[model samples]
Target: MPPYPYLATDYDGAAAHAAIFMVQWKREGDSLARYLVRIGEMTESLKIIQQALEGVPGGPYEYFEMRRFEGLKDPEWNGFEYRFISKKPSPTFELSKEELYMRVEAPKGELVIFL
Candidate 1:
């Protein structure tokens, strides 16, 4: 379920809240992307956020989010990629984990914003 802020007693309020989430999400995401790149760290957060919003493997809404923080060091990425998929969506629990390609390739972008 979406957060409580998205709940509304009327259609107008619901639309207003949806708009609010869009605006606030962009504003906050930009600011956070900047902050994460501060202190000389090579950053590419916009891409990551896009990756999360796009969802993973199961397609679009299948996965709820994908995130990474400062950890590990590989030539491609100096962090850990977290792909979060909700089991409730497809409910294909019978399949083995290997049957599902859990990891997802992230999006690419070059935008920055900071608080």
Candidate 2:
């Protein structure tokens, strides 16, 4: 499996297959290898796009949930009712004090993040 959890979400596995080819053919500081990898990745991306289009679920092009604001009255000022007002306070999130580190495969190379 790839180091990143996000890569596993590729349902058709095209990206992961392309990644494997890249790892096998990539060379250090080689422009030609980089170019080849980019081409291979593009081909795989096209395949993934085609597959997604073929498997798309048919439904309404757009949908709105009027029930979200049901029974809530907006305040009117100068004949303009403010519909964007929040009905409730937003939730807050707090992170732990411990340091965190993560790394993922990027197009150019591995990307590292520290917090």
**Which 10-residue span in candidate 2 carries the lowest summed lDDT?**
15-24
User: Considering only N, C-alpha and C atoms within 3 Å, which residue pairs clash in candidate 1?
Assistant: none
Off by over 4 Å in 1: 1-67, 79-98, 102-115
lDDT of each: 0.33, 0.48
lDDT comparing candidate 2 with the true structure: 0.48
Candidate 2, superposed: residue stretches over 4 Å from native: 1-29, 65-115
For residues 20-111, could you state the per-residue lDDT of candidate 2 as single tens digits? 21222465658888888788778766765665566566666633334533544553321222334222221232446896555555788757
Top TM-score prediction, candidate number: 2
How many clashes in each candidate? Answer: 0, 0
